[model samples]
Every structure is written in structure tokens, then in C-alpha cells.
Target chain A: MVAQIVFIIILLGAVYLFGKNVAKVRRNILLGRDTDRSDRPAERWAIMTKVALGQTKMVKRPIAAVMHFFIYVGFVIINLEVLEIMIDGIFGSHRIFSKPLGSLYGLLIGGFEVLALLVLVSCVVFLARRNILKLKRFSGTEMTAWPKSDANYILTIEILLMTAFLTMNAADYKLQLLHFGHYATAGSFPISGFIAPLLPSGPGALAGIERGCWWFHIIGILAFLNYLPYSKHFHILLAFPNVYYSNLKPKGEFTDMASVTNEVKAMLDPSFVPEPAEVSRFGVKDVTDLTWKNLMEAYTCTECGRCTSVCPANITGKLLSPRKIMMDTRDRLVEVGNNIDKHGKDYTDDKTLLDNYITREELWACTTCNACTEACPVNINPLEIITEMRRYVVMEESQAPASLNNMFGNMENNGAPWKYSQADRLNWAASDKVD
Target chain B: MEQKIPTMAEMAAEGNEPEILFWVGCAGSFDERAQKITRNICKILHHVGISYAVLGTEESCTGDPAKRAGNEFLFQMQAMVNIEVLNGYNIKKIVTGCPHCFNTIRNEYPGLGGTYEVIHHTQLIQGLIDEGKLKAEGGESFKGRKITFHDPCYLGRGNNVYEAPRAALEILDTELVEMKRCKSNGLCCGAGGAQMFKEPEKGNKDINDERMLDVIETGASVIASGCPFCMTMLTDGVKHMEKEQEIKVLDIAEITVRANGL
Candidate 1:
């Protein structure tokens, strides 16, 4: 009774805390401006299945894709074992499903054991890639200590949790072999059977070790669940919706500003009268000005740096890293969310996502090549945020670079970006240089 | 020879209408080097006997650079004015030499109520060759010369027209090569997103210089280009590397014209 009550308290506490964090994240994402992504249900479903569920995009880098496949599949299949553990924890029963499931229980547990071993091996390889190989994508200017540590910590925790699960199974198998109390010979331990011999033979010592491992495994999983919203690992949950809501149009099309359209209409025609304008800002000044889809995209970034690796500006040693852009957006958004929690919802912060986090140099360095968008496994569009900030810089403040200003002026006056008159528009046709 | 290229106004006034409208973009009109590409496109169109007319003085910038540079007001203004002129003529199909113009009119203009069938000149060339209107006959045989196609970001990834441009080259007898990054994974020639109008931000090397390394790796003697901005950047990159004598950066249309002896 005492053990079951303690398990119940811990389980409830973890659930409540995880629920609170998820709500906070949802609220923070909703803090941005509203835009509809509800259209094209059929297409969105197909894309979600292909990109998120099928992991099609992840296969672009075949080696990483194969390694990730093991971890992803293992995590999902092992969760079934977790369901059994949760039931066992609540009712203080040892392999309760064993009686009803009979022979099938052994097959299920045997499969999970094999997967646990694969997951363990994959984690070690991932750790070595980050620490020993020191891949360039993992060490960008924005990666700093915390982002690096976050990645390492998650991998380390998974290793510890997988260890606990296998050790618990091995101890249980040993107890069952001796036909100890309440320890039925139920599970077929293909992997744990090998480790059972390494354990001590005393029944009392084996029981204690099994109990300790069980508690540690379940508790570790609960802790990892809560850590997700705070870490880049949130993509495990957010990738589905993010890929589904990604821009469906051709990559070249930029969203037109409806407010700009109204203003231009009034200026062009004397008879045209526009509607009374609302308090509309030209473009994004902060997280609040961005669309909810854009904010969700920030939360979904995996920090994998695939986008950064393929980015033209970043590849050429420029200050613009698409991964860093997503990181900054997420950071600034969390700060804004915290500010709202401390103060009122309408409270203003002294800092913005513009000069305070992302600088003008980084924004201007982009070529808008859409490489980052194409490279993203989750279909996150960093170029959209970059262009939005550029709009705030130029349309709101009229502070575009001098060269761009010249090009704009030339387009307005000369019917082109150059200083030639429109009369010469047809001059190329008469030229004899047919090279 | 002074080519008699008829404007839409001239053709319309003569009680005749063209089957297609050739959008001679700003770079094609003003830039001295890009004009060579314009002439090559015209030679192919004229030789194929495709009835096309230019917009002439009525044509304006499609506002791609302005929108990309974050001046949406200027971009929309340019788009609206151009749409009106295009709508007035009841243009059903259009072709452009520049991907920037092609992208703006085909994709962005429709949202503002201007819609038409827009295609890049390379796609037009591919169609002409596919329909048996053009052929690689009597020109310099590039049988053994090494050539590679640089996928302009706007034309390749932006619009997903990779096969058309490659098809135009496949019909030639040249040993066509590919850069390390080509098609959807193509690297920019460092001239996109209004970066052409401004100096790049402080970096370890210029984007074109880095891209030139990819071009050099293919060991291609001739670099096939499509977009005007890419042509300028690649031509400059060849000069910067002092490989101007060994490598020639020619537009795809220019190559098609040479291949067909147009």
C-alpha cells in the first residue's frame, strides 16, 4: 500500500507539471498574430504522413537517417513497455498482463528488449559524433554552451533510462528462474537473459536491485517528458503539425502586405477611397507581430543545423545561420512569455527580436535561395521570418541599405531598377550582338 | 542586321496579335552584357517562327527586387501598373529572359488579380525543341567539349523547372556535366534576394568566389547559365579566377541558338 501510494503521488505530480508546461507553450505560440492554415486538408494530411510519420525528408542524409530510425522506432516501441510498467507501478502487480497475454507477452517483451539494446548503441554513436567527431553543424556561433549541453544531456538521459530498463528485466528474469515469490516465468528475455548471470544469486539482493531499477526507469521517463518543452527535443511532438502547416505555394512567392495594397490604391487613384485604417504595423517588430505559424515554427526547430549546413550565406562564412535565426526567435519568445507571466499581458519589454537578438547584418546576408527551407526536416521556413524582419526595418523605418534604396528609386522613376529611360526598353531588340 | 522586332502596340495597331508576349526584363533592356542573351532568345524565337511581341515602353520592372528588399509599397505599385497594361492587351501567355521577372508575374501577380501563363525562356526553348520546331543542326559541334549547367535558384528551386533546362542541354551533342550542387540543391551565384544591388555583408569570402570553386571542380570548359544575374556573377567569377580564356559563361538560350545555327 505504502509503495503504491508513493508511486501514485509521483505519477500525478509529473502529469500535472507536464500539462502545465504544455499549456504554457501553446499560449506562447498563440501570442503571435493570427493566420489561417486550415485550408487544403487533403494535401496537409498527405504531407504530414510523408514528411513526419514516414520520415521521408530525414532520409536525405542517409547515415544520420538510419541511425535516427533506430532511436525513433525504439522510443516508440519501448513506450509499450512503459505502459506495462505504469500499470504495475499503480497496482503493485508483477507482470499483470502475463496471465491474460500468456505466450504473447514473452514475444512482446523480447522485441522490446532487442530494441532497447539498439537504442543504447545508437545513443553512444550519437554522443561520439557530437563530442569526438565535433561536427561543424553542432558548433555554430549560436550553439553556445547551453544548446550543446541540452543535446548531450538528452542523449545521456536516454542511455541511463535504457540501462535501467534492461537491468530491471535482467534481475526479474533471475528471480523468475529461482521461482521466487510473485516472480512468474512470463517474459522471454533474449537480451536480459545474458546479463542475468552477472547479477548476484541472493533473492533478497536481486529483489532490491529490480525494485530500484524499476523506480529509476519510470521516474527518468517522466522527467524526460517534462524536459521536452524546454529543450529542442520538442520537435518530436511539434514536427507533425509544423510540416502540415508549412507554406504550400511555390517557394518564390512572398506574401503580399494587404495594408500596403490599400495604401498604394489610395495613392494611385484620386477617386479611390480606402477603408478607415486600423492600428496596423507594416511588419514584424517582435514575436507578437509574427503569425502563429511562424511562432510555432520557432518552437519546432530541432537545432540539427541541416538548414544551416545548406544555407548559402552560412556556407560562405556569412553571419546568417538559419538555425541561429530559429533559436533567437524561440529565445525571444520565451522571454516575452515569461514577461507576460510576471507582468500583465499587455506589458511591454524594452527589447525586441530585431536589434536585441538578430542584427541587420544577419538579415541582409541572406540570398533568399530557399535552401534552408528545402533542407529543413520539419519544413520550417526561416526565410519567412528573415523577410518579415526586413519588412519591419524597411517599411516601418525606411532604413533599407543605400544601394537597395537606389534600386527602389530607379524602379519608381525609370520603369526599371537601372537609371535608363523607358524609351530604351526596346533597344535590346535592335542590337546586333547576338552572342 | 537590324532585327525587326515588333512591339505589342505595333502589332496590335497593324490589326494583328502575337501568340505570345516576350517580357524583355530590365536587365535584358539596360545591361550591355544581358542584351546579348536577349538577342539570342530573339534569334531562336525568330528562327522557330514563334509569333511573339515585346511590351516595349509599356513594360516596367516586375518589382521583384523591391519586394525582396522589403519595399512592398514600391513592389505592389509596379505590379499593379504592369498588370493593367498586360490585362489591357489580353495577354494569355508570356515568356521572360530573367527568372526574377518570370517568378513575379507567374506566381505573385496572380494574387493581385493579374494572371497569365508565364514561362522562363529556357522552358520555351525546351518546348520548341520538343515540338520539332528547333534542332541542333549545322552549328559548332560541341561533341567532346565539357559543359555544365548552373541551376539559377529562382528558376530551379523557386519554380521547380529543373527538367526543362536540363532537357534543352541534353538535346545537344556536348558532354554535359553537373556541378557538385545542382538542381534543387543548387548553390546561389551570390546575386539573389537583391544582393546584386548591394555589397555582401562581411564574410570569409564572396559567395560567388565560393560558388566558383564548385564550377571549377567540374572541370567544365563551358558554363551554361539561364538567369541574367547569374550570367553576370558567373562571368565575373571566371574573370576573377583568370579562367576567362578556358571557360565561357553562356546563357542557355545563347547555347540553343549556337546549337541550332540560328
Candidate 2:
């Protein structure tokens, strides 16, 4: 009865946490203003194939890739075991895993145990990679807050879960031995066979210990479920869908000027009125301006700093950092979310956060070359945001690189960006013979 | 009622039916050598049993450069007027030596309800060659002199025609070497998107200069291009780099005309 009460409390807490996260994510999806470019069926399948099934992006770093893949597969396969463990804990009947497929369940459990061990080993290597080896590739990258500590904590918890799993298996095997009244099958768990001799040889003690280990295993899994949302492990749940819906468009296609009227009309009418009211201007001035996918991109950033590594501006001694662009956007979103939470809908101080977080020069320095977006393992489209900001700078503020002003003027008068007269347009035809 | 612009399909349907609607784009009608090249293409078409007409001053800008510069309103207005004038002649199948005009009338005009089946002079010339309507006279190789093709953005990337011009070059006895970033990823000639009109942004390298260096690296004595803008910019780059005597810039039409012994 006490174990039942503890299990109920932990499960309820996990349910509440997961529900809250879902609600938050759903709100972002609905309210975020990104354009839906997922109309093509081929594109959807391609994204699923490349990102979800293939795990193409994550495997750029092989060690972490291997670790993450096993953990991911193990977590998925262990679901049945999790349900069986819960059912056994709630009822006195451990008949869930003891059915016709009992041997198959044992094999599955064994497979998961092996994978868990591999995952645990890989996690240690990752920790050593971050903390001890400290290669430059890992350094100055977007290391999460308390990443080392979090990794160590998650690793410890994983080891404990697996240890508890094996312990429960040992106890079950002993109970099976006691039930069948045979020492021949006792060798299945050699350590448990040794442990069986040390424990009370009666059925009552074995049953009590079995219930205790079941509670430990069930409670450990429930706690992991409850803690999933708040940790970096949240990516284990998020990255799959995030990768599956990754942008498949050519990099240059920016958010089609929501309405082309302002962009279209700005050409001929030298005195053309700027349509500030009807037109949705270019820059992502706030979180609301970002598309749901862009917001998702912020959340999905693993902070691997691959973007920062390939950013030409960053390499050429410029202040522009692509990693910081994602980080700042994420920080700003959280800041806004907190403000909204505290002050309700009247949160108006987001300007200071935007101004301090992203510099205008950094925004303008981007060449829209897509090198950073190409390099990013998470499929983050940083260039899209940069181009949108460029549009804002050019359209809303009437501010552009001074060179572009001359180009615009040439285009206005000569039908070309050059200052040459319109008469020169057909100069290339001089070599041809007219009828 | 406001005048209606004929679509490219409607225009292409009138091929060989009307006198050629000579599209004297802003460059060919104005620049001296470009006009000469245009005259040469017309002459070649005339010699090959194809009758053509010239729109002359009736032709207006295709508005490609303006559109590229994010000035779509002017582009529409210019396209509307050009469409009206072409429709006034009830003419279709507009021919142009300018790839920008070809691309604009062929690709972008449909957005403004002015679709036309536009073909570049090189494409038309290649057709003439394939149909046995035109024949080249040269078999002698221009030994020790190599030629390279500079792909104009509008002709190559914008419209996906990379082969016909090279085929013309092959007949000219010129050794064809490709630039590293030729065809789709080909560097711009510092002319498209109205870039020719304005100063290039502050970069250590010019796009045209970079492209010219690519051409020079191929050891080509002549750089061939379909678009006049590419011809002008590359010629200027070659000159600026003091390779003027060693290198020459020729339009694909000019080369084709010469190859056919026209």
C-alpha cells in the first residue's frame, strides 16, 4: 500500500509536468507566425528519412552520435518493460513479463541492458570529452549551464536505473528459482544464485524483496520522466520532431515578403508611401514575429557551436556570432515568457532585451551565404532571420548599406543598378545582324 | 479597355509567322559593340531563310534589372508597356540577343501576365545548326589559343542553358576550358541585379575580378559569353588586369556568326 501511494504521487507529478510542457509548446506552434512550407509530400518524407530515421544531423560528432542513438533506441524499446514494471508494482501479479513471450521479453530486457551499458560508457566518454580532453572543437561552443554536472547527474541516474534493473532481474530470477524448486535454472543469474544462498531460503522473504526492487525500478523511471522536461535530456524528446520538420527549402528563399505590395510598389513611385500599417515588415522585432519553426529552432539548438565555427564573419574578426544569434533569441524568448508570466499581457520592456542582446552590426554582417546553416547539425536557419532583419533595416527604417542606396537609385532611373542610361541596355546586340 | 499583354505561349505560337520582333534590350540598342552583335545575329537569321522584323524604338525595357533590385513596381510598369507594344503588333516569338531580356520575357513576364516564348540568339542559332538550315565552314583549329565561356547569370543559372553556346564554341575551332565555378555556381559578371549600375560592396575581391581570374586560370585567350553585360564586364576586367592584348571578349552570337562563315 505504501509503495502504491509513492508510485501514484511520482506518476501524477510526471503527468502534470509533461502536460505543462505540451501546453507551452502548443501555444508557441499556434501563435508563432512562421509560414507553413510543408505542403509537399515528397519534402515531408525526405525530412523524415534524413533527419528522424537516419539521425543524419546528430551523428556529425560520432561519439555523442553513437551514445545518443543507443539511448534513443533503448528508451523506445524499454517502454513495454516500463509498463510491465509499473503493472507488477501496482498489483501482486508479476505475470506481465511471464507470459507466452516470457523468453522474448527476457531477451529484449537483456538487449536494453546491453544498450544501456553502451550508453553509460558513451556518456562517460562525452563527459571526459567536455571536462578533461577539452578540445577546441568542444570549447567556446554553446556549452549548456552545468553541462558537465548535468551529464554526470544523468549518467549516474542512468547507471543507477540499469543497476536497479539488473537487481530486480536477479530478485525475480531467485523468486522463479524458489517457485520452481530447482537449483538447475538458478545459474541463469550467477550473481543472484550466490545471493540466493545468502538470503533467507523461504518464499516470503523473496516476495518482499522482489516488491522492494520493483518499487525502486518503477520510482527511478518515474523520476526520470518527471525530470525530462527541464534538463538537456528534453532534446531526447524534442530533437526527433524538430529534425523531422526541418526546412528543406533552398536557403535563399526568405519569408516571402508576407505581402509583396510594399516591395512591389516601392519601385516606380519615387514618392511611394511606405505601407507600415498593411505590410508586415521584415525584422523579427520580438518573439511573436518569429515563426513557430524559428522558435523551435531556438529551442532545438544543441549549442554545438558548429555555426559559430563556420561563420566567416566570426572568423574574419567580426563581432557577429551565429551561435550567439540563436542563444540570444532563446534568452530573449525566455525573458519575454517570464515577463508575460509576471506582468500578464502588458509586458512592454522587451525592447531593452532585444537591443542589448542582438547588435545591428552583427545582424547586418551576414552575407546570406548559408555556410553556417549548412554547417549546423541541428538544421538551424540562422540566415533566414538575418535576411528578415536586413529587410527590416532596408524597408522599415529606410536604412541600407550606403552602397545599396546608389544601386537602388541606378535601378530607379536606368532600369539597371548601373548609372548607365537606358539606351545602353541593348549594347550587346551590336554584334548581331538585323533583318 | 486597357491593353492586354500576350503570354509567352501566345508569342511562341507566332514563330516564323511575323517579322522578327527584334528585342533591342537596353544594352544592345545603346552600346556600340552590343548593337553590332545584335545586327550580326539578325543577319545570320536573315541568311538562314528566317524572315524577321525589328521593333526598334518601339521596344522598351524588360525591367529585369529593376525587378532584381527589389523595385518590382517599375518592373511591372515597364513590362506592362512592353507587353502592350508587342501586342499592338499582334507579334509573337520575340527574339533577343540579350539573355536578361530573354530571361525576363520568358520567365518573369508570366507573373505580370506578359508571358512570351523567348529564346536567346545562341539557342536559335543552335536550332538552325541542328535543322541543317545553317552550316559552319571552319575545320582549322585556332592552335595555341584557348577560349572559355563566362556564364551570365540570366542565361545560365536563371534559364539553365549551358550547352548550346559551348557547342557553338566547339565549331569555332576554339579549345573550351571551363572555369571552376562555371554554370550554376558561376560567379556573376558584376552586372546582374543592377549591380553594374552601382559600386560593388567593399570586399577585397570583385565578383567579376574573381570570375576573370577563373577565366585566366583556364589559359583561355578569349572569353566567350552570351550576354553583353558579361561581355562588357569581363572585357573590362581583362583590360584592367592588363590582359587585354593577350585575351579577347566575344559574344556567343559573334562567334556563331563567324563559325557559320556569315
What Cα-based lDDT does every candidate model obtain?
Answer: 0.91, 0.65
In the range A282-392, model 2's lDDT, one tens digit per residue, is 455666677788777777766667777655455444566787787676667766766776898676783632357777667655544355776676577776666555555
Chain B TM-scores of the candidates: 0.98, 0.89
Relative to the true structure, candidate 1 has a C-alpha RMSD (angstroms) of 1.3
For residues B47-84, what per-residue lDDT tens digits would candidate 2 score against the true structure? 77665666654566676654544444455667767777
In model 1, what is the error at residue A434, expressed in angstroms?
A: 4.9
Question: How well docked is model 2, in DockQ terms?
Answer: 0.12
Model 2 segments more than 4 A misplaced:
A34-38, A41-46, A56-68, A92-95, A124-252, A262-283, A304-323, A350-354, A371-380, A432-435, B1-262
Q: Show pairs that collide, candidate 1.
A: none
Please write out the lDDT profile of model 1 over residues A1-435, one tens digit for every residue.
899999999999999999999999999999988888999999999999999988998888898898898999999999988998899999999888889998999999999999999999999999999999999889899999999999999999999999898999999999998999989889899998888999999999999999999999999999999999999999999999999997999999999888898888888887888787667688877988999999999999989999999988998889999999999999999999999999978899799999999999999999999999988989999999999999999999999999999999899899898889988887777646444
> Worst ten-residue run, lDDT, model 2 chain A?
A181-190
Model number with the top TM-score: 1
In model 2, state the lDDT of residue A430: 37
Candidate 1 Cα misplacement greater than 4 A, ranges? A431-435
lDDT of 1 by residue, B1-262 (tens): 2578879999889988899999989999889989888888888888888899999889999999998888899999999999999999999999999999999999999988899999999999889888998788878677888999999989988989898888888888888889989888899998999999999998888888888899899999999989999999999999999999999998899888788777
